[model samples]
Every structure is written in C-alpha cells, then in structure tokens.
Target: MELRPWALLLSLLLLPSLALAAGKCERLVITGSPDAPPLLWRDPQDPTHLIGATADVLQQVAKDLGVKIDLLYGGTRSLALDEVRSGRMDILADAPLNLGELDNLDYIHPALVQTDYLVWTRKDSTLAYATAGDLQGLKGAVSERARLTPAFDTFATQHLNLQRLPTLTPVFQKLLLGEVDYVLAGRYSGMALAQTLGMSNDLIAHDTPIDQPGLYLAISHNSACNDPWLRGQLAKKMTELAGSGVAQAALQRNLERWKAQLQQPVGTQTK
Candidate 1:
C-alpha cells in the first residue's frame, strides 16, 4: 500500500509519544532515608520495609501513571544512595537536590517535599531565636550529620557557638538541662521524638525553620530505564502533585502517623 501524506503527518505527530512509550519504565525499584521519620523510615513491624510521606506520594503517583514500584528499606542513608547510584535501585524517593549527584542522577523537581529543620529550646530559656543570627552568642546543639544550607553553615561556623552531637535526643537533653541554649532538629521528627521522650511539654519550636530543604524524587542515570521520558514524566507528575495539594496532605498524614507510632507502648516503640 502507498503511504499517503495524511498518514505521514499523523505518524510524525505521534513520534514523540511513541518514543516516550518505548522508553517508559513500568516497574521501578526505589529506596530512601530509613531513619528520616514522617518522610521516609523503616517500618517497625518489618525492618525490611520503608514507609511515610514519600511512600504515600509515590504510591499516588504510581497509581496515576499506571506503574508499579517497590519501595524497600535499603539500609543506611549512604547505602540506600549507593544502591541507587549503582542502578540496583532505580530511584531515591526522598533526596535533596545537590550538584554533586547531577552526574549520576536526574532530579525530578518542584520537589516532592521539604525536610524542615527547626530550632527547639526549653520553654523557660531566655534565648529569642528570630533569625539564625539571633543564636550567635547562645550555645546551640545540632546533629553532627545534619546538612545545613551553605550560608547558614558558614554563619553558624563563624558566629555561633555550636555543639555537634551524634544524636538529637542528647542535644535536646542538653538544651532541657540548661547545657545548651537550643537544639536544631526536624520539625515533625523532633515533635515525635520529644513526645516519645515525654519532653514535648518542656520545649517549643521557633516559628521560622532553621533550614527547609526541598526533597525530590531522583532517577539514577545508571538504571536501564533512565531516559528523558521517565525524567520528564516524573517531574510533570510531581508538579501536579504539589499543585493538587496531594503532597502536603501526604506529609500531614505521615506526621500524624509518626506521632501515633511514638505513642505506642515502650517495648513496642518503632524505629
């Protein structure tokens, strides 16, 4: 049969769609921060599973896109990232956008959510934290592994007196016990932890978040399915999710879930 001009034009119009369909990944393997509660974390009942905000958002996205995903507890944050970098995992459900990972990953932006670090202090402390600079003279405690914005990091390094602790619970203790003036920790996670420790009533968070870094869905470049189609699709869907308020809803739900889990009996407290 002879190819007509109309048929040729139709095929041309459909070329991009065809290419996208061809490159589409139907099933994705994903991992993220196993310790980042309310956003992503290892399930208590099953140490091998991961859940929370990121999982909730991805589940909705997967359903909308007609795709399947296996979100697993891949271990430490470093190990989970390594798995994605090596292509053993197709995606990182919760990742901060960084220039360093650009070579190995495509970040889906209009980020999935933000990881907010809040400044917490004892209710009776005289310290007034209206800005990062306000804590200049006060001794503050922070998680040693916490990631701070470059500007805040530099400011803190030069102007503030800081105590780097291995964990925030210790940091919070120091603040409560009048050892440190303030402690920096995640908003929701800190709330959950403080509640768990029976210290929520003794502390309060500053209105402004110390650092609010947006977390994104990142696709590994090493994956067999890594392509323009996958990246574009995810980014587009993420924008929709953000605008539709679905992402915020998921975050709120996860926060409540985290709070509930923390209220569990002592022996059954979740990881």
Candidate 2:
C-alpha cells in the first residue's frame, strides 16, 4: 500500500511533464516576405529578420502559447514558401491559402487577417474603377510574388493587361510615370509605401478591393514541430486575436512604424 501511494504520486508528477513535452514545442522558426509592410517587412537594422503586424501577431501568439519564435527573412516570398515547404523552416508567418500549398502545409483556420488588395493609380488619373472588369485591357502591374485571388488571377490572365513586377515600389513608380495604368497592391501596405516614398499625394488606392485574401499562419508538414496540439493551440489563439482586434491594431501601429523608419536618413534600407 505504501509503495502504491508513492507510485501514484510519481505518476501524477510525470504525466504533466510528459504531456507538456508531447504537446508543446519549445521553439518554432518562421519566415515571410521582406517587402510586405504593415503585414511584414525586413527589419532595417537586422536584414535577417522580419517585422510588422503579422510578425507582432505571431509573437503575441507565441507569448500566449509559451513558445519562442524566430521570424527570419528567407529571401523572396517564393523562396520563403520554398523554405517552409522544404521543412527547413517550421512556420510561415504570413501565408495565403492556395490549393497547391495544401499538400505541403497545414494552414491555421479563421485566418490571421484578410488583406485587401486595391487598384492603385495616380491621383490625377481618370480611372473609373468599380470592378475587375473595369480594368480590362488597362495596363496594370503587381508583384510577381503576389497572390491576389484565384478568380482574379484567372481573369487577369485571360482579360487584363497585367505585368508582373519584382516589387511594389517599382510598380507604383511605373504608375506615377504612366508606364502602367494602375497597380494592384495591399491597402495598408500600399499606403505605407506611398507615404514612405513621399508619393502619397500622387497615388491613390481604390475603395473597392480587387481581392481580399485571408492571410494565414501555416506550418510545414515536414517540421518537427508539426503536431495536432500546436496547430490547435495556434488556431485557438488566432480566433481569439482576430475577434479582439489585436491584428488590426497591430496593422495600424506598424503602418506608422514603417513610415517612421523610412523617414530616418540612414533607415532608407530595405531587403
């Protein structure tokens, strides 16, 4: 009887620790686009890392989950996706839901946020923009890495005159110089970049969103940390954060942060 009591006590102690070890990962490595601002962008001082609203949201989730996360710059968006796909990185901080990626990653449901991609044009342009159809035959530019929407992608490929550029800045610059009729870009990111380039007065994002794709936190299928427990916890926390307006607040806060960083003379660097 005495041994049984001692054994029960030992079992109680070991159970919790075993469960914790099984259910939780100590650290997760995450990566995302370096040029996506308000959502995420390269840290000027540390080119290896990324910072912005999505990064902040992930950090907050990590805090709540009691895990350490590293948000690194893994080259271009495609390269970042490749890193996660290769399982070299554990998580992708900002991922768009795509049927192709479903094979490689498990995307957390309820999405972190829906990014509104807007049609941007020179403020003086007489572009009557109400629908994607209005942009038919019009010259447009978007980042080569952008995932607007499946339907929009199909429509653009067949009907729209869209050029895939390497980055957003040059796309907007092309709009200013009249090389392109308009550019498709994220609302807040476009605003932040335009203000940073001092082109806020010259550029305008249409109220109608061309595409509003949900940005998700996706875990690589190949990651050592890829488990049901971590995915469930992240999904639960994301649901809470989405309803609490933390993501939106982070977006607004980082929008200003990006602009402020660019205002510095030595801070004009970006990856």
- Candidate lDDT values, in order: 0.84, 0.88
RMSD of 2: 4.2
Q: List where candidate 1 sits over 4 angstroms from the true fold.
A: 1-24, 266-271
lDDT of 1 by residue, 1-271 (tens): 9889999999999999888768568899999988877778888887788988889889878888788988898888889999999999999887877889999988888888766789998898878777887887788899875766767778788888998998767888888899988998888778767876889899998878988877888889988778786778888897787668777677788878988887679788644
Worst 10 residues of 1 by lDDT: 144-153
Q: Candidate 2's residue-wise lDDT over 97-163, tens digit each?
A: 8888899999999888888899999988999999989999789999876767787788889999999
Q: How well does each candidate superpose onto the true structure, as a TM-score? A: 0.86, 0.86
Q: Cα lDDT of model 2 overall? A: 0.88
Could you give me the TM-score of model 1 versus the true structure? 0.86
lDDT of 1: 0.84
